[model samples]
Target: MTTVTSADGTEIAYDSAGIGPALVLVDGAMCYRAAGPMRPLAALLTSAFTVLTYDRRGRGESGDTQPYAAEREVEDLQAVMRAAGGRAALYAMSSGGALALATAAADPGVTGLVLYEPPFLGGDKEYTARLGELLAAGRRGDAVELFMTTVGVPAPVIAGMRGGPGWSTLEAIAPTLAYDDTLLGDGRVPGELPVSVPMLVVSGTASPAAMQQAAQATAAAFPTAEHRSLAGQTHDVQPDALAPIMIDFLLG
Candidate 1:
């Protein structure tokens, strides 16, 4: 993996591969280069794109700076963009959709966007506040549990997850959850996103009804956006189902 220095001098770790146009994969909450869906997705798309997958700051091999803000993250992606020949399309997963869209809104170098289930399901200040409380109290496991419960994870599953080996990693990155929340700002898709690039907002028909609605609302916010619902897919979208959709839209 190579590294790029963000505006704040934070070192971001990333991997770039393949041979065609550049495409950056942005992970949602609790995901990074080693722990998310991006790797397989990158592998599938590399045949058609020079896919760039990175550890968002504070996760994987990346460095984190103090007083984390969404703008800092935007700069982090821009730093990766510099490595991608100064321009690339973005495929943002879950909360990453907000960060990617914000990046495109700020940098005209972003040529296109493919957002999958951005979780624009409105904001809950109380949830955010409680999450902050749990993390501040140093109850990392509790923080992780709270997030899982909030996201509709069943109690029994979260109980099982607590005893898993990967639970430690989730606890370690619990603080970054707040960073993801910050990018979501009150959580309703922002009005008039100043992004004019061709965009596709996608959701899974198998996802919850609210999530599909959020996907629709997100598409409506972009001037040049199309909405697609993948049959029988859930929030954890299948790479095989998604890769072709991305290749077509990105290369079309």
Candidate 2:
């Protein structure tokens, strides 16, 4: 495992693999470098581009400091880009997508970006209120459950899924739940991304309309971007399926 120090002196851990132009994969909630949805995608991406997968601060092998700001997470990406020789193609999912967009907007080192299903609500008041309650109560588990529910997962099925082994794994990293909420920011207009970098905004066919709308909004903000829907795919899309789309976008 290779490592780099962020501006705040946090040691960010990352694993580098494959051979080609650098491509960094940022995992969403409940994901670290080795675990979560990005792991399989990293393996597939390794066959094409040099892939850098890392744990966000406060998760996996990375270090965390007091007062977590979205900017710090952006700096983490910058650190990895520096380690990759100062530039990289980036792919981020869900809340991680929001971070990647924000980072690409701020850091020119991000040459390309691919975002999948960021859960940004346009003007959902009740949904935002419930998210606020979950965050305020410090109910990380409930927050995730609420997110899935709000996205239209049936209550019983969501409950059943949460009771499975996979749910435990997701729950283990639940601390980052608030970070997603922080990025969503009361379900208003997502912050202006307006990145000139080449980008691909992808969403699953089975994902919530709100999420699809968010992807469209994101694509619209970029001067150069395309929106694609993965037919018959869901929010938890297989990495193998996603890797190719990501590679195509980054390599385009």
Candidate 3:
């Protein structure tokens, strides 16, 4: 993986593949290049866009610093955009989608964005408090379970994951879960987007009702955004099912 320096002198590790216009992939909480959905999606889009996938700070091989702020992550993305030849389109899944959108709202260099099921439930402060408490007490596993449960994961499923292979990976990045919560700060829809840059909001046909609503509301919040739902796809959208549609929308 290659590296780029963020505004605060943190080294961000990223893998850039293919050749053409730049496209950056942002994974959700606890996911980075080695352990996330972006790998397949990146391989699928390689022919059309120079796909870039990176470990967000504190995950995978990326560097982390004390006193983390949500804006710092946004700056890390700007650095990635710069490394992508100074401008690029972004396709982000889950919380990464929210971070990408926030960055685009602040920086005009973003050409466009594609967001898949960004969790933007309002009243975020309420949960952040509890999440913070969990983290402060060193209950990392419980913190992970709490976040999973908060996001609608069934209790039985989380219980099943307790001894599963990837539970350690989830617990390893558990603290950053709070950072994800902070990204949507207050969670109310923004009054405006930066310069009305074209965006595409995507949802799966089988995604939870709240996710669908968030996607629609997000599209409506933007002056020039389009929403599309892939039939037979759920929150974990399949790469084969999603790539072609994304390529068409992006290249158009």
- Report lDDT per candidate: 0.95, 0.80, 0.87
At residue 225, give the lDDT of candidate 2: 84
Tell me which of candidates 1 and 2 scores higher on lDDT: 1
lDDT of 2 at 224: 88
Best by lDDT: 1
lDDT of 2 by residue, 1-252 (tens): 888999999999999999999999988776797677887888888878999999898888888875878888889889999999998989988878778877888888889988888766654567567766876777767877977776577899988987888776666556566666566665553546668888888998887677788888777766688899998788888877787888777876
Best by TM-score: 1
TM-scores of all models? 0.99, 0.85, 0.96
Error of 1 at 24 (Å): 0.1
Question: RMSD of model 1, in Å?
Answer: 0.7
Better of 1 and 3 by lDDT: 1
Q: Please provide, for model 3 over 111-226, each residue's C-alpha lDDT reduced to its tens digit, 9 standing for 90 to 100.
A: 88888987776756667898999999999999998888887899999999998998998888888888877777777655464637788889998998888888888888888888
How does candidate 3 score on lDDT?
Answer: 0.87
lDDT of 1: 0.95
Model 1, 1-252: lDDT tens digits are 999999999999999999999999999999999999999999999999999999999899999998898999999999999999889999999999999999999999999999999998889898899999999999989998998999999999999999999999999899999999999998989856799999999999999999999999999988899999999999999999999999999998
Poorest stretch of ten by lDDT in candidate 3: 188-197
Residue 221 displacement (Å), model 1: 1.2
**Candidate 3, residue 153: CA error in Å?**
2.0
Model 2, residue 70: displacement in angstroms? 1.0
Poorest 10 consecutive residues of model 1 by lDDT?
Answer: 186-195
